[model samples]
Target: MADLRTTNPDPASPYPLDPADVTPAGPPRAGAGVGLAVPGRATGERGFVPPASLADFAGLARAALPAEVWDFVAGGSGTETTLAANRAALDRVAVLPRMLAGVDTPSTEAALPGGRFALPVAVAPMAYQKLLHPDGEVGLAAAARAAGVPYVASTLASTPVEDIAAVGGTVWFQLYWLRDRGMVADLVGRALAAGCAGLMVTVDVPVLGRRLRDVRNGFALPPHVAAANLPGGRDDLAHQGTPGVSAVAVHTGAVFAPALSWADLAWLRERTPVPLLVKGILDPRDAVRAAELGVDAVVVSNHGGRQLDGAPGSAAVLPEVVAAVGERCAVLLDSGVRGGTDVLRALALGAAGVLVGRPLLWALAAGGRAGAEAALALLAAELRDALILSGCADPAAARELRTLIGG
Candidate 1:
């Protein structure tokens, strides 16, 4: 495979980049860019240069973090078949560019239940962000504020909900249905009090999938990175005194409701007046059912390939889910989204929007607050180029663009 690093022949030029120099490698770095960072940009005190692409961010994050932490962030369930499939599906999609349309500007704004966003992207919920950086969710929230996108706070967030809310951005709360109803109620109330715009109930992770990397690395949350949102600020520990088992695994078993059903969703809907979204719906039937149950939206996800090892890629299943419920409600996607062109393809394939996960985490690990901001900026910039090239003058019009499969 070709080297995926983003380099510059002459670091001064900002425009009219060489096409040969900017092209990605093979399947591994399919959506990554090369040498896209402009020279003489602001740098962090540590001389941290912003990454040029999502792949660059991933490399930096891997180099900076501990082996266990990197594995936890990057690893997928079982053989990681679904993880690879997500990228493979995206790689197969080819945009059919239109020429001489006289389109000068491409608008990226997209509408959600509460408001319109600058792009059709939102920060997907991820657990234990503090493990990656000191700034944690607070840093991510600030970055999301700067990027004009929503930040979905995970149920297992390292920072407290109130602190993240204080950042004053478009925030959504992602809930992992807990066994205790009272605990669930408390979390819901806290999120609402903190000014969250919507509630995304994650239904896929009834039990944590067996992640081989975490098992081999013996990964567990450090003492500092506790799930602050949980009652008593508990961490995911296997047991108070267990020596061998992973704490996260133990926590997953104790908190998540294994028997959760659609009826429980109705119960949740009754409790929160905010827009309720059912996340991790890969099946068209589930998408239809979620909409029928009064969900404001349904997120088409395979839990970022972290659950169900053999499941189809989120992108592979997106078109069917969109067809099932596009008229009934919004159909957002998440899994292996790398950059703007991938976003464009997803829109063309019928996703209303997408939720980005690992790339932001990689950014946080690479350069903390500044890295996260730079990552979002890079994606937005790329999206603009993609829209102009794909013959869409506006992001909303991306839905009408044609896609050639197996490109």
Candidate 2:
């Protein structure tokens, strides 16, 4: 039986990154990249060893990315109060472990409306990944496919849907609700045609957040990076205007649909063929409404605390929404999910699964495909270990464990 115990890794030591963690260690599948024990530094890279701690990837990403790009990826809106709260809320939930129960090799598997997960973790979408590494979404998708997890490709991805799909395996497309319905339908059509199993429509960000870091850093995409999926290309999202104002905010004002309503979402539901998930829901009432609209899932998110500084972390509100609609539709979460214990905590709180954001981006930036793949492997390992210690065999048992909320 596999040992279901894990300890925090030394920040300096290379994690026990086995080839089977994210790569096909035994036999190569079509385009799975060098399946080996080498965790840090993908093929043809130099002097980078994968770190054990997911938090350590941040320094590597910072060193690899330009200041503005880092700010764009890492910074939140306003004072980032909600950003801090996101992590703090996760820390507040204390898991009461059940010892001496016959549990070994605990299962980390999860079932979502999208598909089966080897573990209840999904890659949350972030924009302009090309800036992180040349592999971008293609590399990330390959890693996720190898890990048996879902990858949510951003609408603002530097790679096109067709190119992303060409990497093989079904993916989930994240849509931003662009102003034109024709364009919206077109993007959805392309995503569906490209074999995306799910459509994650982000209902937050009627306007982009006031990320002071981006403003201070004068963040702008390099000339080479452009929205690959958008026809005719978009100069707006790729460029920065003025030094102090948020370029993203300006872009959202001109490009996104602020007046969007539940009716508009209902319209989208009617047209979309794959499983549809609403990506931002803080209120249980709103969750109920989305379930009533027959959405396959409602992702409990505060846009990773990027849109509203005042809002609470998604985990803080997870249970209420789950209670309201857990039976009606799947409930997922995003924002401030750092490690497997966090995933365990979320499952215990009634989240069907948790979407990880910044950590994987850091991995992609630091180690490209290898780093991204290792991120999921690390989390899955941790979740499995946690389940064994807690005497839970699977995600359903995880939901029934004793939980104490507080410091």
Candidate 3:
């Protein structure tokens, strides 16, 4: 491994430390503007100026999208208590930086069962991406490929699995455990045939949570945007609902399997050739159980706080889950991860990597493929800065740093 640590340049140190010579890197790539460019139309042909930060990207997305589509992308379950908690919990963790330790060019590489990613970040599965952009999951997979990260394709994706897989990245399939076993098997076969590297079984949403925003918006898939992976085609995947009910609710009630249990893992395990990971785990016991059941990994998530309104934040429960299963299998995290520092915090708390949602969609909505690429690049740059400033030379070193909670 390369030594990323460099001599510190701070001269006011009691101990012998090199003088501070760190200078801010120049402006980010063409599309990614960090205090260098403003958000607007692309400057030249085949180029665009992305927002300076994820928040800015979100603002652009909100401005670009219709009210209903924005609500579907940003809203959480009823009351959004879990959503608030997720941000609050992450905010409570204070990063304790170390000085005099030489660190530069910090490596953010993360190893998954499929391959090693350039950063400890992956795109989480989100439904109906076509609602955000015409490229949908295919665009996301292309962005992931460009970023050297993984893309977890959702069962509810607007594009078919084969098309997404054809984008040529580390693709992971997220199964919702539909009510019909035949449909489930067929989907799995499609994903496998499409060359997905792993299977992420989402076990949290036995029933869709009551999303008030969607209800108020009378959210339903537009006639054109449909789950393209289903057997009966787009018509079968069309979500039907009334004014008070969300299309998500109606879809789940019709297809989501409520009787799924641990015993069913065997059936899935036997059907797939790739590794299996259970997503939406918060409890330490569940993490342990996943390990016992031969799961390759477990994501400490609360469905991005969209499934259960009162559930604990994924960040708050990450340490406990890590303590329980750190030795058995890889522990990834999702929900409430907003930036590079958040990614570092999760790694310090024992997450192998972090799955990012919402923000990527925001970027995609804002500028299509170029915007999404800029978003990933911005985070990669931020992670590098965070690692160097925190006196860590790599993700492994960041993980070894001491963390303070409730600060």
Candidate 4:
């Protein structure tokens, strides 16, 4: 058996999606107040061909968004040593391939307790996607559905959870447990009502990190674009509620609790019925602890290298976490997964799946929903090719195939 979770144990299923799921929603419309105007270009004029690699997709998306928004989504904490290291770690793994294994087709499906994914990838939950494109999470949800992958929605999503769920894809919700238990329960209730298949509570940020870029940019939400669900007025740039931000010259009074402990996780666990996956796990000891707590899964992430400086990249720690977690719970990976080859490398290292960060926002900035879909479609194709070329006919084979070299 494969060490990590996969949608299909069978290696012969060539097509990932069932035929009925192929219909994609039309291009995304901008959300209210984004002031984004789509030019008068026909759908055909938008072009159907994507670049041969994700690097090219990234280039196109980079050219689309503004400098501040890009920096906000892309920048990491404290010199971004961890940020660059995430990609660099992936560069070190070697995927050893086999010759004449007779693998003509490859299967990418991996079954989960909730359902299966078209590929060993899911779009990680992110905040303020509308900042990248007006469609935001909704656009991403539709694209994931079309591509037969799952979409995990952020608690701070600009688009409401119900709206994103209505796109008819397998959906999960990520939570930032508030200091108030009532608020946490309310958020979990909201997600359950929205038809979320699972709940992932991110435990790493007992308090939001000291994000230097947000401080440097005075990254307050513009009056027109505040988080609608936040207690303070979503549109007020000057409103400071919990966490104090001197950078904006406005102290938001809201302060995320900095005293969270493992006992607090058990407290939060009592309120939700959905399967709970813990994000922000990098330590092997924590991974084992989470499994002992009977958590459904663990996402081995460094918050995309945005939280701590000089922390080990997700790649460096994935194998250890997977080993620690063992078969007790599923182990998913995130942080700087750039392409199909990266996906392959991660799976070989024993990741059940990988999450794509920043690049989706880049795609959204470049072309909204359509651009995001194009990027997903491109990766699916590339993953398929990688599976075949490596002589691994399925995700299970990736666990044993070791002849492929990494970048």
Candidate 1: regions farther than 4 A off: 1-42, 45-48, 236-244
Tell how far residue 231 is off in model 3, in angstroms.
Answer: 2.1
Per lDDT, the best of the predicted structures is: 1
Model 1: lDDT equals 0.78
Q: Which 10-residue span in candidate 1 carries the lowest summed lDDT?
A: 30-39
| TM-score ranking, best first | 3, 1, 2, 4
Candidates' C-alpha lDDT: 0.78, 0.76, 0.77, 0.70
Off by over 4 Å in 4: 1-48, 231-255, 403-407
Give per-residue CA lDDT, model 2, range 250-359, as digits (tens).
66677678878999999999998889999989999999999999999999999877898889978899889999995899999888888888888998898899898888
Q: Please, what are the lDDT tens digits per residue for candidate 3 over residues 1-407?
A: 11111111122322221011111222222333111122345565446676566545666665556556666767678777787788888888888888988887778897865668899888999987878777677877899999999899999888888999999979999999988888898899889988999999999988988877678756778777787887664344246757776776777678889888988877887777898989999999989998988888999999877898889989999999999986899999899777788898998888888999988987787677777888898889888888998999888888887889997
Off by over 4 Å in 2: 1-48
lDDT of 3: 0.77
Clashes of 3: 4
Global Cα RMSD, each model: 8.1, 8.9, 11.3, 10.8
